[model samples]
Target: MAPNFGRSISFPLTPARSFSKSSRHVRSVSLPGTTSSHPLLANLHAHIAAVRSWIQDTASLQAGLANIHALHAALADLLLLPASVAALRCTTSNTGDRLLDAFLLLADAHQGFQECLLELRQAAAESRTALRRGDAGRLASASSSQRRAEKDLARLAASVSAVSTKCARLNLVAVSGEEAEMAYALVEAAAASAAASAAVFSAAASMSSAVSSCKKTATFIPAFARKSTAPESAEATVERLHALEQCFDECDGACDMVFRSVVQTRVSLLNIMTPTI
Candidate 1:
């Protein structure tokens, strides 16, 4: 099915700004699936699958967008926090208070993300119920709630990305060889995170449009079914879904790379923080 709805979505790629002279290259990594025997990888695969299933179950377009927004928020935190913490540690200005402030902000952001996820889940459940009962009014109410959640998620993503860019721009010198490596890795992670979030936002927008189209087409289904009429909207929805799925794949790859970089950053942080006798 071709997406001939005369509407096109464009994703503009911006070159990642280099923050250091080392020039770290970030490559997209493949996500591990359930077929993998490794416990960690298997668990990750299960977690992603569960989230995808939840999105699919919600029938509301806005609900799906809300889920994607939440997912992006989580990734943004993952992408930014380690580097922020590491950079803060390397700084010589107002050490103790700055460290405390950084951690507090991180905690607050994390808590906010969790709360948003809870709200989105509840909204999705309400949407599912309304859809099943064919209650148009309830569905509309749920859609409004989901839209608010989506906006909140978008705001959160933007805030995190801005903080990440700031952290990357900081010129703190690494105290040790291991710390330098970690700093470079953090830069790469930050770049990958920015690209991944963009892909997600684009995909979410496209999917939301497709879901709305699907809803509109549902109203005409009975008429089309009786008369054997070809539905152009249905075909357009299929095309959008295909594109959305591709975007998901790109996001997953970016996430995998970010996760690996995070691990590197953590190991370096641990080494720097450990007391040496």
Candidate 2:
């Protein structure tokens, strides 16, 4: 059965556009913090705006998972552009190296977050099965697993925040012209995308504890015994478990996308550090 999430998931009406400037129509684009009429930078700003709009519309973890991925993937796409490549090449190797370190931190955190999601999803599914089978011991084990996954997510979120902070501190005072503008854009996107990822991590952690209605009693008593003791109906708890499982599955897919994007961005940064003959 399809998981019923009780409400409609609203997404951006516009078809997801490529972050490549060549794929987008060029116009005289002007944005704050931007100095040049560079087409790639313009596209970057537009993508950032779209992501900001998504965050404003629906910041909930369930609804914003794809947006979180989109923001990071857009950052990677921005780095792949010819203009972005030229800007990176113009900067000192030290600056490029620092940005590369930030991306590595993000990539590590993203990988950990994906593992947490997988564990959470598996625990939620096991919990549902235990509840259905009236197996108190199994339910308790599953609930413990869920809590552990939530804690892992919380820790991973802290790492993501640190990455954002690191990106914000990468000052490029010596860079001028298009390099300066690209530096601004890169740092801005990194901070924003990391913030989005961190917010979702926090949200997902809280959501696991909030919706698992039987968690408090599942450790103590059998599901049948909870008929009078539990605050919510067994049916409802089952539905919530199913929802959590689906949500985690969805987030995991998005997390994988963001992780790959982070890796790609790092590869591009490495390319910048490499000397071309």
Candidate 3:
């Protein structure tokens, strides 16, 4: 007897849970000596809030993609199989299986990316707290942790890019005619979303690098002042400050890119899951 391929996979389409809007609100932190809030610490808090928002959005996108996978599996089983064992023998190929495997790998990468984002957010929060408390040691530790998390993000981006390429070249020979065309279109949409996701990660990595550079420069400033026999030139001091400002600008630009790409990916996924009239 041929394997039963007629049964549909029963995956429930539940709406993703909404994250609390309050989580996006950054709490103001006051330094010990200053009555007013620290501006730099406040900015860090805001960055943390933005990271939290991205994490929630990515989670929703993951759920949507899972639903699409379930539907695609059902459609493949229905369209690729015929009554006779002879037909089964003729249709048996590994291309569909590989495509499905690629999808699963992509899903796993997304999960890993989410975890990295969570770690980054926590690290940022800790650094802000350390700043508020005037704990240089703790702040340095937090910065190191953030850098490590950013490294993981870079690796995940590379993985995503590889799997995305695999998905783009996926063979749909098992699904011929109109069915094949539709399947190809769906796969293309997925590929486009994956590309967008890779862009998001790349931009994020760039932002992290810029932040790390700025921190290093800032840390060296006090040491340079203490050790210097002669005072540093005014031009050099201005140049250093300019570099730090540029880093901040780069970080902000990258964050914006991530937000836009993520939104694009979500829209592509929505199209994949929704049926057209």
Candidate 4:
């Protein structure tokens, strides 16, 4: 869904100028209702205007993105179009796209968001269906499920925390944590993906732009992508990609072992508390 911007945004591609020295030097004959001694009011007004301009610029981009998110959240909440629209309107951002393709990409984000919501809802509904049917066999064994849940929860928490605190804006001279590069790449890719989707829907997406963005995403394809950092600075990105592949392999082996250990620990504790069951 496209977000409606209530007002037109004026991008100030240039710097603000104060009244010229000659204009400032001109003596003001006080208007009948106002004090001539007060120059601060005019300055204050200029400052407010600048602030308002900034906000409008932010709204242009934020409004669209917010609406896109709303569509997904509404899908998860099992709400209709109205709910999604409401959600989108409530969200705000600092700016919109500089290019036509970017705005179209926003449309793509909306579709992806909806897909995410649908997948989440479907998974939850399936779990509920199993519970209602009393089909324990359809689920993981009790101990295994418990352990998996704990491991998953921990991984999720760590992932979220890492995203929130670890990422800083991209800088040519400065770098961040091990996963920071991936996060930056992922964010850019997500934005690009959204843009590409929008272009596909809009019938206006440039094939060249879409292809470039697609390559960025392709670099991160599962099993083939890397997540870990290598010690070398020269060709560090390539090395990191290699490390990430190793991590995925390690993940398959370690994940099972780690979860089993967690289950064993929990079961042992339960056994100590209860008589042999």
Candidate 5:
């Protein structure tokens, strides 16, 4: 039942140990756009690579569900027979099986969401790699898990959009669609940035070119649905890849704004719909 995505390593821009160094003398580190070296950004890039690797191996939601179902049938005896009534044995088994199945769905949802999150995280990393290499078209060509992750965000946006619409129809106060779209655009823009370039907002020159999936998710999820700050390596500045990273930042910012606005609108609507819950 797992997604039939076998060639995980086919994505064009895997992390490179050798960065494109413009200033080959002084050793400095910082986030993608910031002025100074951030200790956090350095670790962040490494973690992103690890997370992406983990995602490549994780099973799909359907595979998990199928496993859950198989477990229910295989464990019927353990589920059923109390030392009491003979006729009640089969009935108890059925009831227990149903209850267990219900609980397993929760497990499935939790695990599935985690898997989806991994996919999304990898997508962010992949996007960063593409942008750093000045490969926007390559970023667009992402597929399998990456495609699913992009679709997931867009779907999240669509759901929130629907919720916002319902809110407007029901008369609620929330962020506007225009604002949401802007946030989404920022996130999408930030996604494909070059690691070698300093942040457009940064005044400093030696910041690292590494960006985090969390930063990406946090920025966008709240605002289209709501932002990077990438890292540098030892004695190397990822500056040669500026053009793409700059564009990446803008897109990332856009996505963030859109996510936040939509979510805000939905939350407002939910409050109106269920005041006590």
Candidate 6:
């Protein structure tokens, strides 16, 4: 059935629980099977499925980024619709606040991931230049920086996964009718998207670490032997760097889209929750 966009609807409120570290292990409320019957929600689920598929086969960075972008766009579309906005406003549980917190967490995670990519790009460029100049000291420093960036990305990915799991929980299934179903569906979809994003971050981190390992191997070769032989490891490092650079370039725009969409969705939630005279 179509959502009643024109009709006014409101839901009773439950007292919101405090968000804290202790709540991270709390299991989420189970959603009813009927929530999938909503057309917009079904569309969101399709996007979530696409993201999960890409997560499983993150062999193609381009495809992964595309799926992530689609998921975020779908979410933004769902939340911005008239009926959804109304549902958010009148949620009988604390779903609205939880969703707001989730979006904020996702926004931070995405930004951190973007910054890690930028730092990795810089390190890769420096490594290339250091190799061309045969500057052992500079190359070593660049390799260290690359490794550090990779670690940062790995940690951020873990952090995102934890936030998605903890922050997206919707408790108390007392909400009835279509509005309640929608509120639950939205949180579930967002949590799935967050998990997909974490996978992408982990992939990038692994790529960076691989390139760093190659560079370390290249650095240990004797200069005389290096002059007489083709530097296979060095060449491989360069290739990996090139591939990483390409991936980062492609991801830049996609990351921006997800960031903006999340931020806008948060703003919409805040607007609805704001007290208006």
**Top candidate when judged by lDDT against the true structure:** 6
Model 6: CA > 4 A from native? 1-30, 35-37, 81-83, 90-92, 222-224
For candidate 4, write residues 8-89 as lDDT tens digits.
2221333222212221121111122432222332332233233223322322222333332332222223212232222222
Model 1 TM-score, all chains together: 0.42
**lDDT against the true structure, each candidate:** 0.40, 0.65, 0.44, 0.27, 0.28, 0.67
Q: For every model shown, what is its TM-score relative to the native structure?
A: 0.42, 0.76, 0.48, 0.20, 0.24, 0.81
State, as a TM-score between 0 and 1, how close model 2 is to the true structure.
0.76
**What's the lDDT for candidate 4?**
0.27
Clash pairs for candidate 1: none
Per-residue CA lDDT of model 3 for 21-130, tens digit only, reads: 33212222212232214343233333333333443444333333333333333333333222211222224433344444555545555555555555555565565555
Alpha carbon deviation, residue 132, candidate 3 (Å):
4.3
Tens-digit lDDT track of model 5 for 95-205: 222222222322232233234345544544555565556464655553244545433323222222222222222211122233222222112111211111111112011
Q: Write the per-residue lDDT of candidate 6 for residues 11-93, one digit (tens) a residue.
A: 11331122222322223433655645556777887887777666666687667767867777777767766556666776566
Ranking by TM-score: 6, 2, 3, 1, 5, 4
RMSD values for the candidates in order, in angstroms, are 13.4, 10.7, 20.0, 25.9, 23.4, 10.3
Stretch of 10 with least lDDT, candidate 6: 2-11
**lDDT of prediction 6:** 0.67
In model 5, what lDDT does residue 205 have?
12
